[model samples]
Target: MKTLYDVQQLLKKFNIYVYVGKRIWDIEVMALELDHLHQAQLITQDEFIQAKLVLTQQHRIEEQKNNGRDL
Candidate 1:
């Protein structure tokens, strides 16, 4: 699971800059935008698959952490 610190490190590692959003990170919204581009043939399938994989993993981990059993 990604802690806030890990997320920060990931941003630095990827040289990513995210703008905050109303209910989600701007980066996430941008991802959907990218997906739309991919659907429109702007980005290659390989790039879209890679991004989808990474985002899926992150989301899965976050979901698991959020469902933790009470101690």
Candidate 2:
């Protein structure tokens, strides 16, 4: 089980950016790009895993807030 902190560290380790520009993009886009990179063999499985973890965490947090569970 990887925590958000772990995901952050992994991103830093690979020099991956979560939100570089202010186009208001979500994790799904990032996940898709990462998947494309994986398919192209540009990044390793570990990189993909870390990206997936971070993206999934972001999605979950957004959904929770939208549901008004904890604000």
Candidate 3:
């Protein structure tokens, strides 16, 4: 998908919802859940890859924001 919300919607199709009270943590958990779904062959390779790319981008953005706050 093109955005984090798209990725979340993908996971939601499988009844997976993650919220760790932090954006970064939620993204991390979503990655883990995506991995599990991929390993189980529940999602297509293309889906997995696209979702991962979205998560990675969101994670990077979140990291940068958090880092900025610390400075």
Candidate 2 lDDT, tens digit per residue, 11-50? Answer: 4555766764522254555666667678878778887787
Model 2 deviation from the true structure expressed as Cα RMSD, one decimal place: 4.5
Q: Write the per-residue lDDT of candidate 3 for residues 14-68, one digit (tens) a residue.
A: 9999999999999999999999999999999999999999999999999999999
| Model 1 per-residue lDDT tens digits across residues 5-66 | 34334444445555674223444654665566677786567766666666656666656665
What's model 1's overall lDDT? 0.54
How accurate locally, in lDDT, is each candidate?
0.54, 0.64, 0.96
Pairs with steric clashes in candidate 2: none
If both were scored by lDDT, which would come out higher, candidate 1 or candidate 3? 3
Winner of 1 and 3 under TM-score: 3
Clashing pairs in 1: none
For the record, the alpha-carbon RMSD of candidate 1 to the native fold, in angstroms, is 6.3
* Residue pairs that clash (backbone atoms under 3 angstroms), model 3: none
